[model samples]
Target chain A: MYQELLTGLLNGDIRSLARCISLVENEAAGYESILEQLPGNNHTKVVGVTGPPGAGKSTLVNALITSLLEADKSVAIIAVDPSSPFNFGALLGDRIRMGQHFNHPKVFIRSMASRGALGGLSPKIIEVSDLVKAAGFDYLFIETVGVGQSEVEVAGVADTTVVVVVPEAGDEIQTMKAGLMEIADIFVVNKADREQADIFAKNLRLLAHTKHQPGGWEIPVIKSVAIQNTGITDIIHAVDAHHKAVTGQHQRQLILLADRAYQLIQHKRMKDINKQLLMSEIQQLLEQNSFNLYRYINESSCFTQRGKEGKEA
Target chain B: MYQELLTGLLNGDIRSLARCISLVENEAAGYESILEQLPGNNHTKVVGVTGPPGAGKSTLVNALITSLLEADKSVAIIAVDPSSPFNFGALLGDRIRMGQHFNHPKVFIRSMASRGALGGLSPKIIEVSDLVKAAGFDYLFIETVGVGQSEVEVAGVADTTVVVVVPEAGDEIQTMKAGLMEIADIFVVNKADREQADIFAKNLRLLAHTKHQPGGWEIPVIKSVAIQNTGITDIIHAVDAHHKAVTGQHQRQLILLADRAYQLIQHKRMKDINKQLLMSEIQQLLEQNSFNLYRYINESSCFTQRGKEGKEA
Candidate 1:
């Protein structure tokens, strides 16, 4: 089944792509086998959009997708929303916001709930993005349910991270102070028709001024009323500029590639170890307080003897 | 140093208590050793207070602490704040709001930042709470940085969790609809002097009427203006009543105790294992993407073979 899914994904079957994402995101059985087939077929530009809740991120993403489609590009969006604690499902309000685009052939949108996952991105977000890429989307956008710092971490996983903000949320300084300001390749002031838009833009620029870049490129703050579709072209231009800047840095690209490869390998191995470690028997021993995790790690035969000697030393 | 600190903590030395919390919150060198000394001293009651930002949580906590102190109780507060990404220090606004209690001999207030920790409880929060318990506090209040749903996980680690909301923000249905509503042991309608207080209270009562509690206890919604100390005593009484009820249930108490013990032991072992895993050579291997973490775990001889076999089977 896993091999068939991989073949179907590589062949750009949208149904296979959707199934692969569902499998990865839900951790369906045989996810590791699917993941093992991914490394060779996973080249895609992943973009992350994140901001405080109520910043019109979904609308902005819809606008971005429209623009991308205008240029004849296929797009995939993984929009994350907080799950309803009672029902354990996506709130679906975000889905309603993008209802108009539901039937657009050039766009595919999926709503994922945090679902007891820690940090902003689901552990499988990267894997799903890979599947989306393999499905022939020219761009894949990951939108996080922006609560706070976790959103920043989720944005960190993307190749180009766009940090969205509102004009009068009193979070302008807080966002800049939160270090998210530094990570943003593009600063989007959404809901620009609201009062204080100009002042917010000035503050963002001032914050950007203080950020020292070796390449001397300034972070551009674009004002967009996403609901009205204004300033989106400028936003797209800034995104393109950032993509160019990042790809232009040959050394940074190599470092990023190396880091990603390392993470992929680590993730694969950790999933295997975690499956073994979190087994019911081990959990029972842990619950009984009879199992010592340190001792268990040291004595397990799955590891090399060099690791054993290192632990002893 | 850790042993001396532990001894000082157990002997009820206040400065040692403060310094130890600071270290744990900062993940300083000796934090793990402090936790290793903590298990037998787990006697304090932990209560978590969480709500939307600017819901008057800090003020309510201050009022509660003062009321507790009037009864001659020693209190420890762990105020979770969003860390400044630049310096990795707390934003400190929440701590500043409770500054008046900082000098009180019976009160220990420590500000903890999320510090990008995925688990709602910082790796250090559990440890610091242990030290605070060892320092002989009768009550420990953990006030989390109010993001949305994630705060519920922090409340899970506490004995009693209070979800605070304000009048005029929205109706009771909206409050309950918010993710943290179900996590509440006590619902506090803070700023009750506002015009919408009665309506909010009514909505809460209506919702509470529909809730089926297998434990046979209805969650009470109390109205309070923390600035004026209105209904402050009632809030404390309600918290005490809930705490007593939960503690008096033999099955629930055993479950809580068993869960706490498991967490304590697991955390301690993970710390030790993490230390052994971070040795210089292993770090080098990890950097090179050649360190098989599973292999390392399997080969460590310090652990029992049964634990290893359990992992495999």
Candidate 2:
């Protein structure tokens, strides 16, 4: 069954691709067999669009989709919302914003919410993304909802990362968490028609310019009114420039490749260590004198020694 | 040095408690030693307060503090903001909101951020909460800034979890995420003086009443104007009622106790599996056709084959 799905996926069968993505995302039975057959490095330009919620990220993504369609490029978007676990309302809001792009044959949009998946969100996202790349697209856009460390994880899957912000987000310097500043290859100040937009854009440009970059790429700050269909071309230009700049850096590419695998491996390694077994062991141990939380955890086979050392000691 | 700190902690020394909290929050050297020396289960009523950003959670906490102080109960607050990684802006904001209680002899406030800790946040919080419990406070309040799985993890450490939401949050039925609904023992309609506050409060009451409760405790919904100190007493009453209702449920108590240890153990297990090492190994394997993410992860020593079946396989 999975072989048929994989062949269909590689042949650009849309229904097969959608079914396989859902299976991978949900980690259904036999998902591992499907993942094992996936090819490496499909050479798709994976652009990550992330920003604080209410920063017009979906609108920006919608406009970018239209622009990409105009340039005669096939695009697939993975709208990843980690916040939807808190509220499905935001996910619904996102769909409404991108509603117009649903019918375009050249555009593919999939919305994912981290509801049932607790410790597995990142791995599922990476796997589904790989499947999407295998299905073949000229460009892939992945949009995440928040600006926390989770956003940093999203950057691992993206070749070019664009951090979107609005005019109001500029008032407080503290709002731009350090992790967000470190990963941004391009900055889009969206909602440019709003009050204080000009000042916000200027301040953002200055901040991006002043931010120390150990790499050679100069981060471009683009002013965008995504709702008005303006400044989308500039963002495309910035993305192109970043792509060209980073393509020559072989070391950075390897690091990104490693990062993509890191989360998947870490999650997979942790999955077999059952929480129920650990909790049962802990419950029995709590009544004993040697039942210190730290000691017990440190002495676990994974952390310290295997069975031989444990038995000997 | 830690001995002196531990001695002061047992004797109810304030500065020593602050210093020890910093040490534990930072996971400094000898911190686990300090944790080991502390007594277990000091009978502190730990209440967790959590909500979305800009929901005025800190102000609600401030009002609750005043009520608790008036009751003459000595209190220690662990204001756990899992959002800020930069210079302690949210922590400072929380302190400012609770400024008046800073000098009170019976009140202790400490702020914790997720800075420098990625997967370690929940375990550190659980360990620190245990330390605060050992300090002989009548009550402990743990507050978190964002609505994510991290907040749910924090709820594991609390006796009663209070989720604060404003009037605007009541409009969408989809706004209440599943995990939040499950953990909420009490709900606060904060900022109840706004235009739609009354209707919102009624709607919240309906929503909470409709949710499933396997534990047989009716979740209470209280309205509060935290800035003006209105409806604060009702929240306290709700907490008391929840405590009385759940005290006899032995199974539930054991479940909560196990949850507190679960994260600590999981984190400790993952800590020794270095990402850079795994990534480099994965990079090497990616060149081989047989290299699969899931297969490689499964073959790792931790996940499987550490003990019983390895010799046979």
Candidate 3:
């Protein structure tokens, strides 16, 4: 079954790719063998588009896809929304926003809910990204549901990260955590026809440049009105320029690889912990009226009582 | 040192409160002893106010504080923002928005960063919440920098969640994942003077009630121009009403306690798996041509060599 799916995946069968993603997402039996067999280090150019909500990310991606298709590039989009496990409706709006690209032969669009990871990015997303890359897409756009915490994590998985914003976000830019500035390769001041667009764009450019000068790769801030499909060609050009700029930055690439590896290692170590078993266990403990979270974890054998920090018996 | 701090903390010394929070946030030595000694399950009424940005949460929190103080109630607020670790400026805007209460001895305000949790919440917030509850305050308000994924997690920590919104969020509400409705105990339409405020409030009331009939709590949809301090009294009354509704719901309490315990256990188990160590190891592996993330984690001795899934030999 695995061999058949993989052959179809490499041969660009969409059904095969979808089935493979589902298998990896659910961590089905022998998913590890499939992931390990995927070809290593493809230059598929993973680009992440993220910003605060209402920043027009879906519209921007629709425009971006149009420009890429015009140049005859195949694209796979992983739209990640941090949603309720119960709410499968997260992607319905994306379908409406990018309706033109819904059935396009060269475009593959998939919406991934933030699967309740202890942190922001699901471990499955990294595996799915690799699967898509092995499927031989020319570009992979991982567009995130722009909010507070998940933006930086998305950057770790992408080669080029685009931070989108509007003129209304000018005040917020000042208070932004500064990590966004470091992660972004390009910034788009979308809805650039709005008031304060030029001023916001200029200020953002200043902020981005002041953060770092990595390999003299200057971060460009482009102004676009995504709904009108304007300034998309500029975004595509900037992406190409960024790809050229980071060609030999081997050390930086290694760091991102290490970050991904660290998350993978930590999560895998937690395989023994089943939350259902834990909840039932804790319910019994709480009835004793002495349920201290700190003390309980320190004494519970399942959670590091094998002893770190030398505080345990 | 902890003994003196505990005495001061119990005596309601503000300096001691700040120091205790820092100690817990850092997980300083023997801090678990302090937590173990603290009074268990003190009724401190943890009310979390959360919503999207531009929704006037801060202003509503300001009004909430004023009403609480007027009735001789002391309030401690923990503001959680998922900001960059590099940016300390996340709280500066909070300070200005909540300026009058900043220096008020009766009101204690603390800002908590997300601290780059692999998920959206820091485990530290739970510990800090427990610590503040021990310090003898009438109310503990956890005001989240609400955008997306973190909102539901905040709900798990809060006994009563107040989801604030604006008339503008009406469109986004239809597409919202059902989890928000489940978590919110109260919905506030802040900036009710804006266009469509009444219609939006009516729709939200419908959405909030349709999801569940929890103890017949009747989730109230409040329309308040928080800037004008209108409707603050109604929110306070609704909170009081909900408090009475949840009196003997021991099962619900047990579930929340278990959830918190689950997070505690998960983080504690991850203590010895340091990222810095993992990075050095992965950097070396990347130098070789065959570094599959899946294969490395599977074979890596630090992560699950003891083996639960039986996939490993």
How high is each candidate's TM-score? 0.72, 0.71, 0.81
lDDT of 1 at B41: 30
Q: Rank candidates by TM-score, best first.
A: 3, 1, 2
What tens-digit string does per-residue lDDT give for candidate 3 at A1-313? 4999999998888889999999988888887789988877677889999976567888999998998999999999998876643334445676687888979999999988765633334767788899999899989999887444467678878989999877753233464425467578999988899877887888878787776656888999999999999999999999989988986687777777877776665566555566666666677776776556667666655443223332333
- Models, CA RMSD each: 6.8, 6.2, 4.6
Highest-DockQ candidate: 3
Q: Positional deviation of A165 in candidate 3, in angstroms?
A: 4.8
DockQ of each: 0.11, 0.17, 0.30
Model 2: fraction of native contacts: 0.19
lDDT (Cα, tens digit) per residue for candidate 1, span A1-313: 5888888887777778888888887778766566555543344567889876667788898898888889988788887665545423233566777787778877778876654322222445556666687677778888886453446545545778888887753332443334566567778998899778998788888887777654566788899999899988998888777776775454444334433432333333233333333343344544453333334444555344433443432
List model 1 lDDT by residue over B74-137, tens digit each.
8989877655444232335556769999999999888776543222234466566667877888
* Tens digit per residue, CA lDDT, model 2, A1-313: 4899999988777788899988887768877777778775465788999866677788899999999999998889998776534445666888887989888887788977632323434567778788888888878899987523456667777889998877763223334334466678998988788787887778767767766654667778888999899999999988877877786465676577666655664455445555666656666665554345655555654332342232211
Assess the local accuracy of residue B183 in candidate 1 as a C-alpha lDDT between 0 and 100.
67
Candidate 3 lands at a TM-score of 0.81
Error of 2 at A198 (Å): 5.5
Per-residue lDDT over B60-127 for candidate 2, one digit per residue giving the tens place of the 0 to 100 score: 88888889999998888887765534425665777787889999998998876642323335467787
Model 3 docking category = acceptable
